[model samples]
Target chain A: MPTMTDEQVRAHLTHEEDLSLLHEVSMKTAGVSRLEMCIQCGSCGGSCPSGMDMDHTPRMVFAMLRAGMRDEVLQSNTPWVCVSCYHCVVRCPQNVHITDVMYTLKAMAIREKKYRDVAAPEFAETFVEMVEKYGRSYEFGLATRHYLKHAPLRMVGMAAMGLGMLRKGRMSMKPRTIKGMDQLTAILNKAKEMELT
Target chain B: MSAYTFYPGCAMESNAKAYYTSLMAVAKPLGINLEEIEDWNCCGATEYVGMNLIPAYSLIARNLALAAKMGNKTVLSPCSACYLNLAKADHYMTERPALGEKVNEALAAGGLHYQPGSLDIRHLLDVLINDIGLDNLKAKVVRPLKGLRVAPYMGCMVPRPDYNNRWSDAEHPVELVEVLQAIGAEVVDFPGAATCCGGHMTQIGPETAFELIRRLISSAERSQADIMVTVCPMCQVNVDAYQGETNRHFGTNYQMPIVFFTQLVGLALGFPPDKLGFGTEITSTEKALARIGVDIPKPTEDTPHKQAGLPMPSCLRKNAKGKVQHAEKEAA
Candidate 1:
């Protein structure tokens, strides 16, 4: 992760590029405007289920945005903490588009190599890989791969659990792929082209 | 009669076979012809859009392109994730001209072009309530689910604030509840109906997934719902099959039967329990079915409903508050 002083963090946060992307995606998807509408009210912070676990509360993130602390905002562990529950969005008096902002910031953080933890992003990657390969999520494969990638030792315990499930017929060993793999491949490639540009 | 281009997604074929089976069984009685789009692909499920926006939307839009070409004005998706992706892509394309241009360019390579707003993408539940008309549905009841209490869980993807396709309030959507009641099932106004089931997260991070699932199931149990009815196969699998593991991980005991909306509809339509795919469920739907006096029979080849050619019952006619009027008014 990129390290920066308070002044540098503030400078990066205020930078035009950082703010522009955040503004763009929000307006494009949620029709939310004015990140400045946040009044630092505690409604969003209070309602967030994971608020206490967050280093920077949703309210604080908005405050930081107003202060133009782009680098600190991007590097902070705040964005990843949001569970996308829309609780903040529902309760926010300003309708400040908290979730969309978090999404954009996380994307920026990932692009800038400033993310704090790899858990959520890694999970997302595993999901994309499944779609790229099979055109669908292979549950058994995803479960095994997730453990193998994130917590290798957990596989031993999961294996025992898998055996138990197998005996009871709760789990299936065979992985199922979606029909029309070639068509799916073409779609994925098209998606990739858009991402590249 | 209603005709829709169908995007089954992947789960319908494998993990959620019961959902597909029940959907096919019940739809025929309602005169819903779900013509599958030819040469269709996955909607990238729940995760791809989060990882990469353009590719994810492109991936979803490819299916929409095919549905549009098949000359179907409406696309009905059984999976919540697929419904969300298709709706989101359609919303974004109409709202964002530049992105629409870029995606159209990509589709052009496949000899396809999607006109934004050319197709109305909807979930199966949306079609049932908005198109099939609950009043008409209420009249077709060969059997009514009078005593069974069900919590209608919409999961995450279907009703969020996206472009204008949001059919109900994002936090508390009761459209499914209204449909369940039309079928004579007691619908519970549960708290976690709109909660995420940790979806594909169950595979990538079981710990996080466990906590999320625990919260949802516990809430449903507390709400006193006997079984939870879902529109998404992914949600059904996560809540139905993984609840035991979630309980074990959290040291709590929950024996909730997670069922598809179609299965409950099938039961209410007087279809036998076996025909509704009740035997395949991890948690016994038998007791719930028994509550409504439905007996489980041996699995056999699904027989089509005898009452096939009847005109849609009067109650099913579009109401003034109906979705068709609402969309048409908006268009006018």
Candidate 2:
């Protein structure tokens, strides 16, 4: 995929133009009724730990979702960059589950294959993949794989810390596999099927 | 003695070994008995749920299901993310019948079933501070962490979205402070104690995560804290592991040490210092924890002591009304 140009990104900008996407998102998230009642108080933006990292602040993202700007909302980095701090959710006067809404948007973005920052999705995928595979994650292994896949140059910078951790026995060099992973697989498979319905 | 099924989470075995080790050291002293759940899997963290909800919850619920199978009603998780995810799924599955049915449907294939709300999922902090009571903790403090100023960093998850109203105040939770103080540490009024530490963003986007990490460290520093004590593994890893990178990113010389809350608790409990696993931190914790009598690594030529450090940046502090009040605004 080609890197998105600023023009291409700007062209996709949208507002509360439709109720369809908003309705869909609301159905999936708990305490979503407050999204519509959002006064755009900007309190969530103020409380956000990573607000500056996103192309759109969380308040604006909610507005965009209500505006029915699927293209813009799905293409946003807000959902991906949201650390699920709940600072915004806890602080929102409207009492909207802003974090849950972010989760809903993230699910939507993944399902639609829209990514504002591909590394976010990659990290989530790599992490979940490891958990699904071993029933537990190997930290150093996960970090090595993730960095190798996302930012190889950055791995060199992290080597010292990795070595430091390894020397201290703070990280595992090998994967830790649990027993009855087969049973876990059976349950997860059923879960996957259930999600489809 | 209350025996609870323990879910050590994935990090306990690997990255956050200090936390697991420290908790274990204090467990016997605190009269807490933890039976490790047989064949426990990952809690799926924050990532899996974003990928797919049902499977992720089922993945978390599977652990709950196993605990129930063991006839254990209380499951103790030391990691903040693990505790929250476990509580979240358990609470949601019960609250939403549809989700409950779907999760139970998945468990049925393994001849396992999780009837949400059957298990009492609690963070180790909750069990220790609230359950054990601060007075009992004071009784165990053989060595009070006197004259040590520590900032209580609870990260974002442990307090918020409180499924059971278990936490005191989500925005400004003082349980960590209460516990730390009971054990004889000077718990600073860290305004950003409950601030988000930007979990996996450090991996996905270093620049952004660094800023967030920088904010927490800076806030703690401004509060005149010697070290930052945290309950969450993610917060510890991000702040401790990424402190160097964050400093290099922001042109700052902050060397704050972030350690697990349980490690400090163990120290106060008079457990052998070695059992707490103190020296595993990437950032040197010697200077910060010296008052507590934990052996710290000798400072290298690079990290000097008794030197005046960079001034703390003026940042916004959370007011009583849950609004961010600027430092200057307060001062003026």
Candidate 3:
């Protein structure tokens, strides 16, 4: 992908005219009252360790959210790259739950099926699938499946580390499921059913 | 013995086996009896909350409900993600009654109920530093890490959103240093100690994650630390596993052994290297552990470094004849 020109940037389709997106985000994130309290101080941007990777900083994202740019917000790589480090949440003078908001954005992306950042969503999907299956994260299974599904070439490189850990007894070949899995599944199912309606 | 329900989380049994092993070694010495929570599931990590708030919190709350049913008031977790999720669920459920009702409705199918604030979710580091006094920890030290300069990497989760007012300081908690100093290691003032490791970003965006990883490693190296000691399994795995990739990205050769704090404490407590499982790291603890006179096996000679990140295959410029005209350039 080549860098976009000034004309391309101007021509970029933005849902800035969509007011419903702001109301929706505000309702979901009403808990973080600081969503409206952000002063646009660049502390979050400056303090972010992975800010360079994100298309928009925390401050920018908040501004974009308020501006009702639904497509722009969804297309930004900021939320997917958020590792939940909480640097922005803690440092915000307004006490905004920036990390949690990032989670909200990530969830919105997945729900809307709009993934700007390609790999993170796959990792999240692989993680959720693994947990939904055995009630625990099986590293060998997760790594094998994640690499195979996403990047098969990298699996060759990962073999040495994966096999080394396996030989060292750090990782296991067998999957581990917790007791009372039926009850756990019932609880999860109930939650899913409630979310639908 | 102070009793608490132990939530080892999902990683303990697999990728972070060393943490599990070392924590087990210290349990007896610390006189803190940890009963394992039966049938504990995943905490939904950082993903589930974004997809659907109710289910994610409920999944984490289910573990709390299980612990409460066991009649335990406190729950201890070694994994940072587990600790944060458990604590966050308990906190949020109390703050939002509607959320609490919805989550409880989900739990009702399992014939269970969780009362917010019923369980005290604490990180293992907090337990070791607070419940098991540093004096006792120091007294139990058989092999002190006297000359080893350690960077206490608490990651980011343990400190923030203290919701319960447990951590002394959100930004700069001295818990790791206090505990490490008791073990006789010189703990450095690491600025990136509290900074994010970009969590699962290495998988999402390698370049993005690599830069974040380099910040901590290079910061520790600049501080002249021998090794980095961490409290969270994710932090340990991220710093340890992707360290080679971080080095490759920056064209720097930094062989920092990112280890679990418990492994170091286990060594200081006179636990055998094999018993503590110190050699399971990808960064190779040989150089780091050697500073404390505890020798571990090397990471094997065939693999010069641990396999991590995306392998950069070399691309060549083609001439008219298609013969290799120039040295192979690293593919971007």
Model 2 alpha-carbon miss at residue B263, Å: 1.5
Give candidate 1 misplaced runs (Cα > 4 Å): A1-47, A50-53, A65-81, A90-98, A152-197, B204-208, B295-332
Ranking by lDDT: 2, 3, 1
What does the lDDT read for residue B54 in candidate 2?
74
As for lDDT, the candidate ahead, 1 or 2, is 2
TM-score for each prediction? 0.80, 0.88, 0.88
Give per-residue CA lDDT, model 1, range B101-178, as digits (tens).
Answer: 777776766666788878888889888988898987888888888989998888766776544545687778888889
User: Native contacts retained per candidate?
Assistant: 0.21, 0.62, 0.57
Give the range of the ten consecutive residues with the poorest summed lDDT in model 2 chain B: B316-325
* Residue pairs with clashing backbones, model 3: A107-B50
**lDDT, candidate 3, at A163:** 52
lDDT of 2 by residue, B1-332 (tens): 77989999988987798898898888887889999999999998888888887788888888998888887788999988899889888877776678888888998888888887888999998998777888998998988999889999988888997879999998989899999999899988888888888898888878888888988999999999999999988998999988888887888999999899888888777776567878778887888777666785431222111132212322311121122122113322
Q: Which ten residues in a row have the lowest lDDT in candidate 1 chain B?
A: B301-310
- Interface Cα RMSD in Å, per prediction: 9.9, 8.7, 5.9
Predicted chain A of candidate 3: TM-score: 0.84
Model 1: colliding residue pairs: A13-A69, A13-A70, A13-A71, A191-B55, B135-B315, B136-B315, B136-B316
Cα RMSDs of all predictions? Answer: 12.3, 11.2, 7.9
